[model samples]
Target: MSVSKLLSRIVAHSSDRIDTCKCVASSLHDHTYGITSDPLTQFACILSALIHDADHVGVPNTQLVKEETETAKRYKGKSVAEQNSVVLSWEMLLRPEYCDLRGAIAATDAEWTRLKQLVVNSVMATDIMDKDLKGLRNVRWEKAFSEQDPSEDAHVTTNRKATIVIEHLIQASDVAHTMQHWHVYRKWNQRLFEEMYKAYKEGRSEKDPSEFWYKGETGFFDFYIIPLAKKLKDCGVFGVASDEYLTYAIQNRREWEERGEAVVDEMIEKVKAVWEEEAETTDTFVDEASVSL
Candidate 1:
C-alpha cells in the first residue's frame, strides 16, 4: 500500500537472496552472499526502494509525455516520473543536512561509486513499462545467467549475477501488489484504475482507462507480471518468497480474467459517484456563502 511496504519487501527479498546466493554464486563460502554480501549493496537496494516513488503523481509516464509537462520535458519524455523521483530524492540525500548520513552510508570514494551505481540501477529498474528498458533487461538477464567462460574471474561472475539480481529484485518489489494475495491484488488494482480514470476525467490522458483497463491488465499479467514472478522463482534466490509471488500472480491473473470487466464497471460508477458528491458539496458551499453575504 505504501512505498515503505515495498521497502520492507525489498529488505526481505535482499535477505533471502543473500541467504540463497551461494547456490548461483559459484559455490562461494556458506557465509558469503555474493554482491548482496556487501553491506553497501543492501543499503543501496533499500535506499532505492525508499525513494523510487518519492513524488509519483498517480499518473503514468506516458500521460506525462503526452501532456508535455515540465517534468516530462525535463526528462525528455522518457521515464519522466522515475527520473523526477530519482533527481528529487537523490539530491535531497546529497544535501548538507545529510552529510553524516552520507558518511555512514559511504565512507570511501570507491564505496560511494558502487553505492551510486547500484542505487541508480535499482531505482531505474522500477520503470518496467518502458519498452527499451525491457529490451535491455533481457540482455542483462542473459548476460548474467548464461554460462561464463572458465577464464573469467570468479568475482566478476558473482558481480554480474548480483547486478542483474538487484535490478530484478527492485522491479518485483515495485509491482509487489500484483504478486500478492487476491485481496491485496484487488485492492491495489482498484486503486490503480481509480488513478487512471481520474486522469482521463481531467483530460490529462489521451485514452479512457475504462475502455482498455480490463484488457490492459490482462495483457500486463500475461506479458510482464507472470514472467517476472517466474524469473524470481527460477533465479533460485528468493527462497519461499518467489514461490509465493508466482502463485499469487497466477491466481490474481485468473481472477481478473474471470471478473475484471465487472470490477471495472463497478469502479467507474464508484469514482463517478464520489466526484458527483464533491461537486454537490462545492455548489452548496457557494450557495450558502452567497446567501450569507
Candidate 2:
C-alpha cells in the first residue's frame, strides 16, 4: 500500500534477474549478486531495492541543496533525499510494530548487519547523479574488473567483482523503465517530464522542461541509459536478459529520436489542460464562497 512497500515489491522482481554467469561464485557471493544462490545476499539486495526510494519528494537533490531545505541541511547537501529515505526507512523498520517482521526477514545478528548495510549501500548507489559518487563507482568498476591481481586471493577477487556488480545491478533497477518495454519507458519518461515541468511552473527549476525535453531524452539515451544497459550486459550475470534490456533500450531510444517531439507536445498540452481545469475549479469555489459570505 505504501510507496516503500510497492517499490520494494518491484525491486524484488528486478533483483531476481541476477545470476552467476561466466564468473564462478565464491562462497561470499553465493547468496546474492551474481550467484543468486544465498538467501542473505539475495534478500538483502531485495530490501535495498525496496526502500531505496522511500519518502522521495520527487525533487532532485541539486534543487534541494540549492534551496537549502531542511533535509539538505540535515545531510550537508550530499544525497539529501537519499539519506533522508534511508534514515526514514531504517527508523520505520526498527520500530516495535515491525519487530516480528524484522525477525522473520533477518533472523540472526550477522544477517541483520548484512541486511542493514546492504540496504544502505544499495539505496545510496541510486544517487548516481552525485559527481563524487559517480566518480568513485567508475573507479571501482575499472579497478574491480581490470586485468590484474594475478596473485590476488580468489575470494578477494570475487568479492571485488561482486561488490561492483551488485552496485551496477541496483542502479540498473533504479531506472529500469528505460531498459524495459518502450511503452513502459515512455510512461515513466513522460511522468518525469511532467514532474520537472511542474517544478519549473512552481518555481523550483530555472528552465522550462518543454524547451529541452526532446533533446534531454535523446541525450540521456546516448549518454546514460544506453551505457548503463551496456554495463548490465557486460556484467555477465543476467544471461540473455541483459541482451534483452540493451535491445529494448536501443529500440526505445530510436523511437524517441523519431517521435519524441509529438509526444512532448502532447504531454505539455495535457499538463496545461490539467492546470487550467484546476484553475477553473478554484475560481468556481471562490465565487460560491463569496456568495455565501
Candidate 3:
C-alpha cells in the first residue's frame, strides 16, 4: 500500500478530523492544481497535508513560542507546527511498512530534496501571520517567473527562484478554498475557522486576558484572498475555470460575513468542548502517574 493509504488508516485510527485533511488534499490535487499524473508526487502532497497537523494538539505556534515549548525552542519560532509535523512524517515514513513511500521519495538526491522542500513549503505556509514568509516568498516568486525558465530541472532546483514559485503554488493550494466556488469556499471556511478556534483553546493559557481565539472577521478574505486571487487569475496557472471560481469565493465570503456569527459561535463552542474533555483526560492521567510514582 502507498503512504496515502497508510495515512488514511492512521487517520481512521486516530480521529475523523483526518477526513477533512484528505478531502482538502484531494481537492488541491484534482480541482485546484489539476496535477494528478505523478502518483508519488500526489502521494507526497497528500502526506504533506495529512501529517502537517499530526499530533497537533490544536495549539498555535505563537503559543508554543510564548510557552517556550521544546518544539518552539528547537525550531526557533520557524513554523514550529510545520517543522514538527514534517519530522514526524519523516519518522513514520521510515518505518518498514512505510518504507515503500520513503524509498520512492528518496529515489534520488534530487527527488528527496524536491519532496522535502515541497512538504516544508506547504506545511509552513499555514502560518499566515509570518510577515517575513510573505515578503520572502513574494521576492523569490517575482524573481522566478520573471526569469521565465522552461526547464523541468530548473523548476525543482533547491533554494532557487523556481523553488520559490513552486512553494507558493503549494501555499496557494493551502488557501485555495478562499478562491474557489462559493459552496466549496463556505464549507472550507467553516472548517478552517474550527481549526483556528481549536488552536485558540489549546493556546488560551498563553494568551493575554483580553485575547480570544478568533474574531470572526472577513479581514483574511479582504486582504490575503483578494490580492492572491487577483495574482492567480492574472498568472493563468489555474486556467479559465479559476476565474469564475475566484469570483464565487469572494462573493461567498462576503455573504458569510453578512450572515452574522452563528456558524462561528458553533465552531467556538465545539472546540471549547473538545479541549475541556481533553484537559480532563490529561489531568486524570497525570494524577494516576503521580500516585503510581
Candidate 4:
C-alpha cells in the first residue's frame, strides 16, 4: 500500500483525531510553519502523526516500566514502546516487496538524521501520563526558546533543537483538543479521560494512581483541561487557533458537569472496578508464590 493509503487505514481507528491532524498539518504547512510544503518533510510529519500512538494500549510509560521489569531494565526507563514503534515502522518501509513508496521519503544523510529525530521525539511525547517526561519537556522547551540565537538562521543551528521543538509542537497538536470548540472539545476530553482512567485503574494494583488521575467526570474545566489549554495559548507558540480551542474547552467542561452526578458516578465506578480486579489478581499471585515456596 502507498504510505498515504496505509495512513488512512490506520487512521480509521482514530478517524476524528487523525483527520483533525491532517487539517492541522495542512494549515501549519500553508499558513503557520511553512516547512511542511516540502514533500519529504510533510511526509515525515504525517507519518509521525499517524504512527505516534499506533496500537496504543492506553497504558502509561511509568506503569509499563513498573510492571514489565525486563523491558524496563532493557531500556533503563527510556521510551521502550516508542523506540519499538519507530524501529518497527521504519523497518516496514524497507521491505523490498513494498517498494511502492520507497524513496518518496528522503534517506539522505542530513534528511535522515532530521526526520528520524522528529519521528522519535514526537512518538515519545505521547507518553503524556509520565509526569517526569512532561517536566523534562517543559524544561527542554524553556531552554530551547531561551537559548536560540534569533539573529542566526534557525535552519543553520543544530537541527536537534529544531527537531525537539517540532516534536513538542506535534504533541501540543495531539493535545490541542483543549483548545477546540465546546462541542468538539467535550467529546475528545471524554475519550482522553476514559483512556487515562483505564491506565490509572490498572496501576492501582501496583500503587495508587498518581493523585492527578481523576476518578470522576467532575469539574475538569474549572480544575484542569480548560486552564491547561489557556496556558498553552498563553505560551504563544501554538498560534490563535489554540486560544479559540481553549475557550471552547472551558465551555465543554461546564456542559459536561451539568449532566449531573450520575455520569460522574458511573465513570468512578468503572475506574474503581479495574482497581479492584487488579488488586485481586495481585493478591492471588502473591498467594501462589508463597505456597510454591
Candidate 5:
C-alpha cells in the first residue's frame, strides 16, 4: 500500500482497537507538543508509525537472532526488525511507481535526504533492543526537566529535543494498546503472547514462553509501560494523556495481578484453537493445490 493509505489504515485500526478516550488523551498529548502544527515533524512521526512493523514476521529480534535468520545476520543482531522495516519501506518508496509521489513530497534533493534520515532515525529509535538509546533519552530528560534552568548549556539541545520527541511519540503510539481499556489491552496482549508462544513451540526462543507469560506482562507494566507514561508526563509535553494512561495502566496491572493466571490460561486455550483451525485450513489448501498439480 501507499504510505499515506497505510498510515490511514493504522490510524483507523487503532481507533477501532483502542478506546476513544485513549485516542483523545493521545491527541491532547500531541497538541501539547505542538505536533499537529509542525508539518515536517508530524510527517516524520506518521511515517515512522506506518513503517514501524511494515513486514513483521510475528517474531521478536531475539528469536530471529537465536535462529540465525538472514535478517539477523544482515543486521548483525542490531535493531534487526527496525532496520528491516525501514529498508523495506524505503524500497517501496524508491520504486518506479512511487517516483511522482516521492517527487511531490520531496521537492529538493536535500529535502529528500532529510526526510529519509528522519524516518530512519525515528523508526530505529523504536528498537528497544538498543539499550543505549533509552539511557540517552533518560539523560536528556534529566537535563531538560530536572534543572532549575532548562535553557542552560547542560540541558537538552533544540535538535535533540526534536529528535527525542518524535522518537517518544512513535514509541508511545506503538504500545498505546497496553495503556488503554482492559479489553483492548487484553486482546492485543493475547495476540502477542500467541506469537511468542509460536516461536517457543518452534524451538526458536530461549525460554518456555508460556511459563512466564503472566509474570512477564506484570513486570513489563511495572518497569516499562508505567514508567513510559510517567516519562511522557515528566517531559511536560503529554501530561494529560500520560496521566490518563498511567491511571489505566495501574488499574490494568492490578486487574492482572488478581486474574492474570486465569486470563493466560484462557488465552492459551484460545490460541491453541485458532492454531488448529489455521493448520486445518492450510492443510486443505495444500491438498487442493497438490490435486490440481
Candidate 6:
C-alpha cells in the first residue's frame, strides 16, 4: 500500500489520539485540494501528514537523545523522531502486503523517486530542530510571494510552489489546535500536557511540565501560532481557513491571558485523576490475573 493508506489503517487500528495525522490531513483537504488539483501534490501532502508523527514516543527529541533511545542512535541525534517516522513508514509501505498500493502510487521509477523525496522533505520540515527553521521559511516565503506582476503567477514553477505549500500546510496543521475553537484547543492542549507530564514523571524531561504549561502556551501562541496562521493567509492559496484560524488564535490568546492558570490547574487535576484511575484498574487486572494463575 501507499504510505498514506497504510498509515491510515494503522491509525484506525491504533486509535486516533496517538498522533496528529488526521488533523493535518483534514486541514490539507481544507487548504490544498481546491487550490491545486494535481494528484501527486495531493498524494504527497497526505503521505507527509500521515507519516510526520508515525511513531512518536510521547517525548521530545532532546529527551530521546539524552536517554540515548534506539531512535536517537538510529538517526544519530539529528531529528530523531522525524527521521524515524519517515523511515519506518516508508519501510512499511514497501512491505509485500502493500505492494499493490505502492504500485498504484508509484507506477514509474521517476515517479517513485519524486514521491519519496517529497515525503522526506515535507516530513523533515516539521522537526523544528533549531531557530533556523523560521529563517529558512522566511526566505522561501519571500521567494514565493515577491512577484509584483499578475502575469508572473504563471511563471512560478510547479515544483517550487508545491514544495513550499506542502511544507507550510504541514506546519500550520501540526499546530492547528492552537488556532481552533477554545474547547477544541483545550482538549488537545490537555492531551499534550498529559503526554509531557508523563515524561516528567518518568524522568525523561526536566522539571514538572505543569508548572509552566500555561505560560508556555501563551508564549507559543504569541510567538509561533499567530505568525504561522498569518503566513498561511499571506500565502494566498488557502482561502479563508487561515483567516478563520487567525481569528481564533487571537481570541484564544485573549482567553488564555484572562484565565489560563485556572484552566491549567483543572487540566492537571483531571490528568492526575485519570492516571490514578488507570493505575487502579491495572492493579485490579493484575490481582485477578494472579488469582487465576
lDDT of 2 at 67: 92
Looking at candidate 3, the ten consecutive residues that score lowest on lDDT are 6-15
Q: State every prediction's TM-score relative to the real structure.
A: 0.85, 0.87, 0.64, 0.61, 0.79, 0.79
Among all candidates shown, the one with the greatest TM-score: 2
- Give the alpha carbon lDDT tens digit for every residue of 50-139 in model 1: 888889988889878877899999999988888888889888989999999999888899988888788888888899889998799898
lDDT string for model 6 (76-171, tens) is: 988889999999999999899998998889789999898898888888888865456657866776766664445554435444555676787777
Question: Taking the tens digit of each residue's C-alpha lDDT, what string does model 5 give over 1-293?
Answer: 22232223222212234458777556543433444345665677778888899889978887788889999999999889999999999999899999899877878888878888889888887887678777876786665456456455532354555566667667777787787889998988987888887877776676766789999998989998888877765555543566676788888999999999999999888878887998999999999999999
Per-residue lDDT tens digits for candidate 3, residues 1-293, read 22232222221111223448667555434332333334545555676756767777566778788888899999998888878988987777778997686675678878877777677776776667788987877776675455555564633532354244344445556676766666676576666666665554545544421134134346667777776666655444344434654685678667767663665566556666876899999999999999999
Q: In order, what lDDT does every prediction score?
A: 0.78, 0.77, 0.60, 0.58, 0.74, 0.75
Off by over 4 Å in 5: 1-37, 147-156, 275-293
lDDT of 4 by residue, 186-249 (tens): 4665566567766555453443433433434344456556655655454443444545556666
State, as a TM-score between 0 and 1, how close model 1 is to the true structure. 0.85
Best to worst by TM-score, what's the order? Answer: 2, 1, 6, 5, 3, 4
Where in model 1 is the C-alpha error above 4 Å? 1-33, 289-293
What is the TM-score (0 to 1) of candidate 3? 0.64
Better of 1 and 4 by TM-score: 1
The sequence of per-residue lDDT tens digits that candidate 2 reaches over residues 108-179 is 898888777877777888898899989998887887766677888878877777677677777877888888
User: In model 3, which runs have C-alpha deviations exceeding 4 angstroms?
Assistant: 1-43, 104-106, 145-165, 180-216, 262-293
Between candidates 5 and 6, the one scoring higher on lDDT is 6
Highest lDDT among the candidates is held by which one?
A: 1
